[model samples]
Target: MENPTFSIQDIPPTLLCYAVAELDFSTLSPNLTNSTLQSLKSCGANQLAGLLSSFTTITSETLVSLGSLAVGLSPSVLENINGSILKENLQSLSTINNWSATQASIIVSKCKVQSDKQINADTLKQLGSLVIGVQSAEIKTLKSDDILSLANNSILTGYMEKAPIVLKKQFVQGIIQATSKTKKTIFQVVPAELASEIPVSNLLDSNLNVSEINQMKWTSSQVLPITNQAQCKSYFTRVGQANIDLLPQGSPKRNTLLSNAKSCLNINSNIITKDNLVILGSLVCDLTDKEIISSDSYVLDALKICSSFTDSQKVAIVTKLKAQYGAPSKWTLSNMKQIGSLSSALDSEIMKTINKSVMIKFFPGLLSVLRVQHKTTFTSVITQLKNSSRIAARDSLTCEEKLTTDSITKQMDLIVARYSAAQLNICTSNETLLNNLNILGSLAFDDDQLKVFKGILDMRLPGGVPNEYLIQLGNIARVYSEKEIRSWNITSVDTLATLIQSASWQSNDSKINEMVYRYLQLNSPNATFDGTLLTVLAPYICSLNQTLIQNITSGALRNSSQSLEVSTCNQNIKNILFDKMKLGYSSVNSTSNAYFQIMSPVIGGARFSDLINFGKGFPEMDLSTFTTLNPNEVKTLSVENIKDLLGSNVLDINTISSSSVLQVWVASKTQMEVNSLGVNATAGIKSPVPNGVTSGVGVPHCTLYLLLVCIMASLLYMDNDFL
Candidate 1:
């Protein structure tokens, strides 16, 4: 039925009579509010009585929430309210056999205006009885004069005892709820005529097992009908916002979310009973700071939901699933061969984007996963769940009853297989890179991990990160032609230099700049990192590492020292530096490659570069006109040219019987320093001064940058050789 329409003049007769009778004193109950009695007493008993006699009625629903001030008044105040000459509805009070003195007074003051004045007086004399008849049985009725005083005294006692205060609370809450409901309905129609008609109890009856409802009647508690979609959405949004705010940052909610995302690769359908929305929601909530909103993480999760779950589970989950892709079952390694592109438009979540790099490294493991694991797919499960929800709209399940591990792993496997190697490596290693590798990426790589990343570039999972891990790592290295290492998280010079050195050593001449670019990108050569830090990077460009690689490749780097005792041809370079120029460089005459030795002699670190880069393109040299090539005029040459021009042979003066460029012998001085050119490296130590630049130029301006620029035009010479 529709609502009954009414105007002011159309008020119901019952409502009118009830309203007028309310003004009469008959409406007063035996239990008067002391607060009300006190308030009206202040207005005098005659006026208060008259107001009560003419009291009107209202709808029971509206009136159910009303209360009075009787509990707040003293006995004297109640007496004053009764004695004041304003009441008229007490005429029928004479028949009372038993009543409280308070009830008698209430009746008389209410009926005093009766046409039969005699009956009115008589009733006032005996007033009592008939008070909701079933409850109040033993009280004696009181007479006219005594009734007023007794009622007033009772009212005072109520105020003192705080008995009537309880009654007022119910009245106010009822009024507030009714008024709000009425207002809400005034603008919007409530389809159900009454509370009993709501389907809430039907939807949540015993089988739902939703115990422990919050008893408060806040607006949120209202069982809003589904008919109002806007209200329903508003309610859910409010709930979601509250949940996010309540969870603090960095808590479990924030931590390890990345790892959880990775686990999606191995998730199986055995546990896909839970809603797919949980994964979607977590992706949204946890990806707080990662800049990419529609990131790789989001897409992967959405795919997992759409593809991995079992048919039954799928029907129950994936709420608000805008994507219509069908679920798949029995994922096999062969399925891996099907998807050409790794990215699918599933859900665009943030964690997926920021950590896409780390996820790339796990392909081998994931490939291994595909070869041996599991039966059901996430698609079957999610599909089953969605179907269930569609059939049972209001039915919801508990979280644990929702998802378990066996189920979650099936979902993750699809993600692992679908992701690209570069992207996955980064995402997979996010934890390691962000916290460990990234921080020390610039630190000195004396540590074993850095060494592993540089050389091992690709290896077993437990080993250090590889170049391919950071998306930008290989790009900056400029070593596109070389086989890529996997640790891109190496932001530190030590790690980057290690990567640089490893790539440079194994790298072809063309690929050197690529390696250099990557190293510079990580180390930021122009960015002013620490000097000690820069020292670590120096070796990546030029290193004693070559001696070992040459051995590894030719069965030479691993040889014993005796095995390396220079042959007639090998010693020319070795003996030249050893006997002629006498410049100390770390030396090992081919001992077992594992057992290495270093030179303790006072040779500056930079001299090693001249020795290493001599012929292998450390900046090739092929100068044409030494006389015509002025220092002011520069010409560019390949790293190979510079090396050909600067080899030990060029520095090897046959008459002098020396193949080394120049000597750096030790002085008796205890300090380690530079000695201009020929003296001990320790001959030029300076005292500490405010903001000083060390006057050390071990590297030639032509070694990397200048060398490439001028290799074709200038002769390779030491500072002393220039003299």
Candidate 2:
């Protein structure tokens, strides 16, 4: 056994087994190579059993020498290993994340036996990921002091991340008890990972010092557990202004916090004062319709920007303003400026009443927040204003001054914004407007408008639309007929990328696919699609036929940077992409946290069984993807998963209901559990979708359309109505 030239490969299996049995454990341990371990594993189970039997006592060194071969060891053999040996070697042992539950449990049991059945910080740290194998009852037995001692350590946090809901609750209860007595609050003592586990009851502690709470950093997940009227009141009162200011505008946390705060505060608008409104700040957005109507105009004026007001709330404020000022027609420029962003709430009728001077002054702020329907009306108002001014100026100015390039450009913008397909005759007759037809890209044309606009564009670019003109067309390119798009000479991937990325095709699948197909056939006819090209074409990749999608290389899919956009693709496309993704990101355990991190964007396409395989990484799924999950599949998610998921949005009811999967999942939980999950049992549910918007396959299509138009308008005509 001590031969200097000896190699495991040189020895016969039978002889090597006997030699391994006879060798000193310490001497052989250090010399064991991965090759030597594989050779040992290949020796057949019976032979290895004979070899293991020869050792009277197995030490940590002996197990370390086994390396991956430990995975091959039977439970009976593992159980026979001494607890002291297991305890000392737990750190090394736990590195193998693929261990079977039975195998890991045996290690935990042996470690506990050595430490008097109580898991302390040192032992817990040593267990590493094997803590996932620790049963719910064992987790319940975790002492408060032990958890507190490891407050700064990641061991408990790591365990809570992957542990089942039932186990996490038990562990969280221990944490609640552990932090209750300390001068520091739970926010001060608990690791951020375990922050979501704290219940609303614990969070609503009346004894909490506001100054102390304000000083601590709060994550959206940490605040998500406060859902009900009682919790919102207690939580908001405790959180202080500093922490509240930390929430981002239009975020789910801020929305839900204000919603619940308004309900709980139950402010009386009839008697509310200016100072009270100032103190309420963003919470004023939550004031009921009746309350808004009753509130004094001067007091309402004290409030500034309302980042996200519901359509009904906006109407109520407008109604109150009209009552105070008579009608918008009678209101002066001073009145329009006084209302600030409330100007966005004004209806078409009210807008028509507004004179040219007041609207020009107010348009900047109003344009940013105008509702979709109001945009068309506002465009007509601009047209009327422009026409009246032109008539007055025409009598005083010569044709040379009236038809100047700047004046014609301004007129082109007005016509594009105001004219319908029938009214487009004026533009067709004007050579100057036809030359600046790229301005048409600022608006989304219907089929009739597209026909008229296309005729004008064809007349302007009779040589056939080249790459430069196509790029300038912006979203207008999306409306081109398939024959017109296919006729374009696409010479560079950059040109294709720019047009595809810039243009947002609403439901024009055929047109988008035509553009994509033409680009592939012309620019990349023989080339294998790389990450750069794949990402560039991501917007319309779903339109690719099955064969083309399946042909996309695994390496390209792994390296592609358009995962967020790709996640929005149809199920068939995603399924194909995910197949290639799996090949690129192969894992021994597909459910591990590492796998989830690499595969999260496309993982939504995974089968229900594969999705349920997720361990600690379950919460990493994005909200949009999380919503598409089967309700029954969501029901099977671990409690810790649900908490972490809900906690991501800070337990906002509106946020939760936005995902029907979460709504159904929340409905199945007990009232007590629901409160613990972060929403109140009594809070009313509201649609997450805004007014005059529709979603397709969990995506907010109308919202996206408006966003694209705004972007295009900003790039083309900075002062267009779409803005």
Candidate 3:
């Protein structure tokens, strides 16, 4: 039978099935011909099953070669196939439309085993029609994250559409259990199609915590199932304003919920107290205009609890306030503060009537909420008040007392500082007044304000923005566009360093890259960049292209004083930088703890062989660098090393478990070690640590260690003070 070279097509038709089954299937040179496979389909099931069992391993090619004869394979043979091989060929195997329930079940079991008992959306999608064969018990075992993935995936939803009701019920229940573990509610997790299948009793269950029901949209049809009026009122009331605000405005769902809650509370706007308004929350907008106007002014103030108010509500409140306060000219500062957001609805004439001091005090709050048209009028009114006030105060000065130049200058500085960014009349203000305006650094000027400020700065410093002015500008320096900053004459290293630090906070990547390029272009020599310059600009050095980065001299990197900030740099950039650092810092032994410590930031770029060479020094590497290592490389680390590396990150176990790639490395550990990693043991690992026993080591004591260190440091400081 060894090396049987005879073609199966040469076999007589009557003997073909017997010849195919009897042949040494493993020793057969080329695969069976398609005509041979077609003839084999007429063979008995036991004969075909025997032929399939001859191979030590089943591959996708073997299955494809079998064609329709694959259906004749015994369940036991399919069950024994390697899960990894099965997962690899699931799409091709799934193309077989006539699989029996038993065959499909075996495939699903193998798939689950391959995925470590957690099937994600892609696997579910590949299963396709075969998903119907999944058992309710198996569906219940799916991870919450996996369930959430399936719920979010539209492709999986199509698969679930044809699945059995029992499986769907189990899937929905899994969603409920999953959502309970996190801040998300059932409404947030379940899709529209599956939502209708959720039982009414489940919706009423108190396990769905009220506080967790913060934000999610629900259609009227979806919510209409919960017909318990009393329960709805209590749940909605406790859920607070956050949930109500998230509801789609003007949707039937919002209208239905409002109508139902209003009826249940027996809300009467005419007799409504401030307490009623507080309890009603966002439902206050549902009240009629006449009802709002009829409500007491004190009761109306409770509307502030709601973040947004309807236009009709604002109008009604304004009318009521005007009636209570009489004329706008007679309205006091107390009246304005009492109205709160109602001031946004006030006319320009009404704003002009307010005292200058009162107006300035109210402008900050009003500025944020004002309509576009009202902002212009308010800005104009404030400007006029500022000019008239300065004139009135100067004119009132006694004739005998002459104003000094210093006094006049000081007076102007005081007046400019008193106004807000919106009220600042930059066009009329002199250079001295603009320089004295220290208030510009504190306020976040809008695009228009920044444009005006830039114009003023340009006129004052016509040569270009100097380093001193950049320091003076503080956060406002960020307002300069990337184009303008790139065009600057930057020569000083200190200015470049300061600009890099400032740009890191608010500037986008493109802008930071431009700033670094501009500074380098101006300062660095045409032939060779300085080592000290590289060290100062280390954070942004990675922004350069690969060729440019490779061109940097090894001597420059070796002589650099500070560590390169590679956290924001991609793997390619880190690889180039790490290579340069390796060559330049040749004096440092690669296997020493010093090497790992110094190279920890860019160690992720190191090759697997290089990491293995680090040996004991590997433990000293940063945890973030460890997370990026290949799973196989991670597997080579000792259990004690893993415990040491992950001990401090026990709190991040959930985040780690969320990633399939990280989970593979985590699953490589012993059950006891995984439990010690501080997550639920039943999910994949072993028995949990006893309540009194600390899980892993480091993380729990990190704070106390810091505290002890601080105390010792303090004692050392005290001894030095005595010396």
Candidate 4:
């Protein structure tokens, strides 16, 4: 009666999704509720309602509880599956996920017998009994005989339709026999329906020791906006009109102070257009939200810019962006997304030649390009950029390729060189003078980047609670604290960490992020630094490979939290962790587990990995790599459903040995090299004899462990802080 192959074609995907959703209900209630049964009864007892009523065995409430085996679940989605006979039919599907030959045969035999019998009262009662027996057996169904052991536990309980029951010897013994592991009886078996509801999330914020409501309580009228949790997504947006400032009327000095404040805040002139909206953005300080009736795009962008800002400087740029780009949504994808395609989404609109330090800090990349390319002249590869507006005036040549046009480089004649930024009459609000600075300082930075950065730190943050006491945090920054950033290469690991941690955007809590970002920024390869710095940074380069050093540390640490944060804070970190771990990591047992646990409620990500791949390194988590999904696939796979599947797989992957017989497909990514053997290299010995086992168990091999320490030392030669 058993079939070798099985398909879930017995039910429609929609119906299946609905069944799972319904079982995942608010409470357990077997009795048919009037809300649904009424609709079915309207169709009469012997009709669709009658047939559906018979399916009471598989209510959505029951099925969604076995969440993993099924997909998405909704309330009342299983009105038809509330009956005893139907519930068994639903449980049978779990066989597909956890299928084995014997279980499959048992299922097939049951189905075959049911099909051969008549569909009357006696048959229905028999089927109900069988379904109850299946529930009792489910307790012992998991691998490692763990479920078997759980089933045998006195604490275990089961159900027959609406009633709960204890397992009998017949079903309990059969499951124990089928289970494979003796000592490995792992997790107690959760009935299939219960697993569906506790969908694990990939991104977890372990930092929060409490709930959101409790966290938000601190940000009330009593606390400063800095202490208040700023919405990380749109901290700069002026939610309503009051948050935005119009010109304040006062005496000349009052006007001057307000003007200076506006300039600092980046408030632009009041030019309310039909399409564009000019508002302040990127400040971490709080603002009250008011209604904006505009349905246009530019205004929305201005709103976004204002909202995106948190720092005082960001407020100024937001003012300028609104003054300049608040025209209309001439292009699609919104101004923010469009501009992001070219530069970062946050463009403070404030520029500074007078403040070269700020310019370099703000636009390091553009500064880097300018440093190498400025006086050195590059011809316009795409000669039309200078005449872009003219050509656009004639005809807007908006194409995918045109939109993505990169910086046009080519040979050019002697260009007028000046460190002064372009005076782009941007976001000045009723000011006495012109603010003429934009990115020119970044160009001149190669000559004075670090000096300017150091000056800025000395000015803004000042010697304080953390950094002033360098021995504590300065130590964290140097050495192989996390990834590739070694000790010698860094000038001030504490300074860098302080910068990122102290970022206004992360004003809601104690600053750990400030430390993270500063480390990454200075670590940029383009910026020239003393050779000793690199020697210290990639210390493994001296003799031991960096990857090997990381490997030794990770193995000793075991996928601990220390390995997690440093492993992902920078691309360099990922490179080292992945490479060292990948050297010979059995595909079946590979783990992407690790994270840096910070001690704050608010933390801006210095490492790129935190946001996109938050909980991935926390044990067993695998994320969706789908660039796009077709409508058909989307229909079958809702976000909730996909999330469920992903959550289960992520948690389970760790348990499943990475060294499985099956081939794993870890993405090909950059990694630090561990050991390289050239084809031409000679092996000193022709053959080496292997000892069958450790000749002596208790014997201490000081030499072997010493070699391991040596290897680790070689890899982290620059790990002064770690040492």
Candidate 4: tens digits of C-alpha lDDT, residues 1-723: 024353223434445432321221223244432233332223322122112212324545433333333222111122123344333554445322322222222332345444544333233233332333233334344343443444443323222212222223333334434432443221223222122121122012112222222222121121222222333112212222233323222324223433433443344544334322333332211221211222233443444423222244344444444555553223223443444312222322222111322222323333234334432211121121223322332322332111001111111110011110111112111111101111111122222322333233234435422334232222122212233222222335334423233222212211232233344456554322222122222212222233333424322222111112231133344345444433323221122221212111111212223222433322212322221112222233322333332443533322222321111111111111100111122222233323332323333233563677646655665565567
Top candidate (lDDT): 2
Per-residue accuracy of model 1 over 434-497 as CA lDDT, tens digit each: 3333322332222233433333233433454444544323222332234443234455444444
Of 2 and 4, which scores higher on lDDT?
2
For 122-212, candidate 2 gives per-residue lDDT tens digits of 6666677676656556656667777777666665466556664555666767777887777666767766666557666777673555444
The window of 10 residues in a row where model 1 has the poorest summed lDDT is 593-602
Deviation (Å) of 198 in candidate 3: 7.4
Q: Judged by lDDT relative to the true structure, which candidate is superior, 1 or 3?
A: 3
Task: Give the Å shift of residue 155 in candidate 2.
Answer: 21
Clashes counted in candidate 3 amount to: 0
For model 3, the superposed segments whose C-alpha errors exceed 4 Å read: 1-201, 204-224, 243-253, 267-275, 285-288, 296-299, 365-438, 441-452, 471-484, 489-723
Q: Cα deviation of 490 in candidate 1 (Å)?
A: 12
Ranked by TM-score, the better of candidates 2 and 3 is 2
For model 4, the stretches where C-alpha displacement exceeds 4 angstroms are: 1-447, 451-551, 554-560, 563-620, 624-723
Distance from true location, Cα of 27 in model 2, Å:
49
Tens digit per residue, CA lDDT, model 3, 264-329: 567744656665566666766566677778765665665554444556766776687778888776
Q: Model 1, residue 463: what's the lDDT?
A: 57
